[model samples]
Target: MKKMFKLQWLSVLMLAFVLVGCGAKEDTNKETVSKEDQQVEKTSYKVKDDRGVEVEFNAVPKTIVSLQPSNTEILFALGVGDKIVGATEFDTYPEEAKKIERVSSSTTFDSERILALKPDVVIAYTTGGDDENLNALKVLEDAGIKVFAIKSATSFDDVYGDIQQVASVMGIEDKGEKLNEDIKAKIAEVQAKVKDVKAKNVYLEISPKPDIYTTGSGTFQQEILNAANVKNVFADLKSWPKVSEEDVIAKNPEVILTTVNYTENPAAEILARDGWNSITAIQNKAVYFIDPDISNRPGPRIGEAVELIAKAVYPELFK
Candidate 1:
C-alpha cells in the first residue's frame, strides 16, 4: 500500500509540472500579443485640417470619398486613386476617376448615397460655401465617418499646402513633397523661359457676355499671370469681380485670355464684342482660349497653366 501511494504521488507531481509549463507558455503568448498590439497602436496618427479640426486615424484610410474635383485630382496624383470609392460627378480627370461612383453634383450632395458607400473618410471642400453640401458632410460626421475639409487654394503656396495635407492624411508625406518639388521645378522651368520676356497687360475672362466675370488680386489665376510674366489688367480688383464692358475697355488689355468654352468659339465672341474691336488685343488678334480645367483647378497641373499663359502672351519668346 505504501508503494502504491508513492507512485500516485509521483504522477501528481508530473501533472503539476505539465500544468506549470502550459501556464508559462500561455503567459509568453499573451506577452507577444500585447507587444504586437502596441506596435499597431504606434501606427496611428492625427492631423489638423484646414478648418482647424483635429482628425485622428487608427491607420491609413482604406477607402475615400472625395467631394471636390480638385481633391479627387490630388488624390489621384498621389497614386491613391484605387482607394477612392466615391467622388463628385465633375471628377473626370485621370480617366480612372470617371469609373468611381459619383456622390455629389455641382450644387448638391447625396448624404445617403455617401453613407451607403461606407468610405473610411470623406474629403470635402469649403470653397463652394454651399449649405447643402455642408449639411451632408455634417450628416456623414454624425454617422462617425471622417470628413476632412480642405480650404480653397488661392495661390501656389496654398496649392502646395493642399497637396501636403492630402498626402499627410493618406500617409504618403514623401510622395507629397516630391509632387510639390516637381510642380515647383516645372514652374521654375517656365519662369526661366519667360525671364527675358517683357511683361504684358492681360485680361483673363472667366465668364462672358452681359455677366462678365474675371479673376483679380488674391487669386490663383492672378498668381499664374504673375508667374508667366504678365500683368492682370484687373489686379486692382479683389478676387473674382464682375465688371461692365466699360471697365474692360478702360483697362485696354494687350492680350485677352478667356476660359469660356460653353460657346463654339469663345475667342471669336470676345473679338467681335461691340467696342472690343478697338482694344489692342482685338487689333493684334491675341485673344486666346485657355483650358478651363488646368487654368482654374489649383492642382498638379498649375505649371501647365502657367506655360499656356506664357506661351499665349509671348508666342515669339515661347516659340
Candidate 2:
C-alpha cells in the first residue's frame, strides 16, 4: 500500500509541472503580440514653406472652404473639388465649382453663413484690398475654424509653390510635387523658344468699363508678362493702375491682351475706343482675349496663363 502511495505522489508532481509550463508559454505568446503592435507606424507628412516653417496636418481634409476664387481653382486642379464644401460666389471656373455652397460675391462675404459649413480649413487671398475678408474669417477662427491665407504669388516659381502649399494642406504632397515638375517643364520649353526673341511692350486690360484696369509691378498678371518675355508698359506703376484712353494711346503698347469677360471682341472693342487706333497694338492686330479667371487667379492655372500670354505675345515662337 505504501509503494502504491509513492507512485501516485510522483504522478501528481509531474502533472503540476506540465500545467505551470503551459501557463508560462501562453503568457510569453501574449507578450510577443503586444510588443509587435506597439511598433511606430508612419501615416502622415510634413510641409515646409519658403520661410522654412513647417506645418503638420492629419489625413487629407475631407471638408474645405475656399474663401477666394484663386484658392478654389487651385483646389480643383489638385483634384480636391469634391472635398471642398464651400467657396466664394466668384469661383466660376471649372463650371462644377459653381455648384458648391457660395460664401460671397466679389469682395463681400458672409461670416455667419461660412460658420455653418464647419469646414476643416478655409483658404483666402489677402492681396485685393479685402480687409473685410480677414474680418469675416476671424468669425470662423474664433469658433476654431482653420484659416490658411495664401498671399498673392508674384512669379512663376511662386505659382508652383502655391500648388505645393495647397497640396500640402490637402494632405497630398506627392501630387503637388508632380504638378510642380510638370509646370517647370512647360515654363522651360517656353523660355527656351523665346530666349532670343525681343521683349515686347504689352498692356493687359482687366476691365474696359469707365477706363482700364491694368496690372502694375509685383502682380500675378505682370509675372505672366515677364514669363512671356514681354515688358509691361505699366511696370513702373506701383498699384493696379487705372489708365485713361489718352494714357493708353500715349503708352502705345505693341500687344493688348484683355480678359474675355470684358467683351466678346477685344480687338474691335480696343480699336473702337477714342484715339486707340493710333496705338501700334491696334494697327498691327496684336490685340487678343484671355480668360479672366485664369489670368487673374494666382493658382495652379497660372502656368496656363504663361502659355496663353506667350501665344498672344509671340504666337510664331510658340507654334
Pick by lDDT: which candidate is best?
1
The clash count of every prediction, one per candidate, is 0, 0
Q: Candidate 2: lDDT of 24?
A: 5
Q: Model 2 over residues 187-252: C-alpha lDDT tens digits?
A: 777778888999998987876857566778966667778887899999999646777878888899
Residues 170-251 of candidate 1 have per-residue lDDT tens digits of 7766678888899999999999989987789999998787888888897778889999999899999997788999999999
Clashing pairs in 1: none
In lDDT terms, how accurate is model 2? 0.65
lDDT value for candidate 1? 0.75
Top TM-score model: 1
Could you tell me the lDDT of residue 63 within candidate 1? 96
- Per-residue error for 138 in candidate 2, Å, reads 2.0
Candidate 1 RMSD to the correct structure: 20.8
- In model 2, state the lDDT of residue 204: 79
RMSD of each: 20.8, 23.5
